[model samples]
Target: MRSSPRLFQYACRITLFTRQNCSLCVNAKQVLSTVWDKHPFVYKEIDVMTPDAKGWQDLYEFDVPVIHIAKTEHGLERPELSAKAQKLMHRFSAEQVMEKMDIISDPKS
Candidate 1:
């Protein structure tokens, strides 16, 4: 996968499922903010406790700070893209997230 570095993280939308009082969620937001500052993307936050959270509350109530990275509408659920392609959960860094994004963008690399 020979392409621009910017191409990897671009066009990716991140859906962050969180709870109101989760400290891990707070930290995850901070890390994601750092990544956004460098390379902006479509970032959406869904509070599991919110009434309008759709189905996120039931899916991730016990798993605060769960992050789903996708290039298109809710694709790439499999973690087999590599270790880097696994769904980010609990504790993660900007680098880990970026690596996953890169693999997602160019899986043949």
Candidate 2:
């Protein structure tokens, strides 16, 4: 009997919006680091205070240190985030990140 081929799934990338001198951002990074130890997802940090990030700063002024899971695609330098992916606050716990990862990873979600 022939066995079916195994399928491999690509890991999702996460974006962290942060700013300098922000205690919340610091705490969020720590939490994310802890979660990443187990979940293992690529993450990028965006400094909203930077001049190049004007748009991001305006949009997330009150929501600093936002965490967003990037949308997956076959080829793209920076994949767009899915509409279903909700922006998480900096206060989110490791467990919450895990739950979000599960939701984002689910094909049906």
Best by lDDT: 1
Off by over 4 Å in 1: 1-10, 72-86, 107-109
Tell me the spans in candidate 2 whose CA falls farther than 4 Å from its real position: 1-10, 74-84
> lDDT per residue, candidate 1, 6-107, as tens digits?
564446778787888899999999999998887666787778788876466767789789888766444544324323433699999999888776665664
| Model 2 C-alpha lDDT per residue in residues 2-46, reported as the tens digit of each score | 533221264666788899888999999999999889977777898
Ten-residue stretch with the least lDDT total in model 2? 74-83
Q: Which ten residues in a row have the lowest lDDT in candidate 1?
A: 77-86
Q: Tell me the TM-score of each prediction against the true structure.
A: 0.73, 0.78
lDDT of each: 0.74, 0.72
TM-score of 1: 0.73
Tell me how far the alpha carbon of residue 19 in candidate 1 is from the true structure, in angstroms, after superposition. 1.3
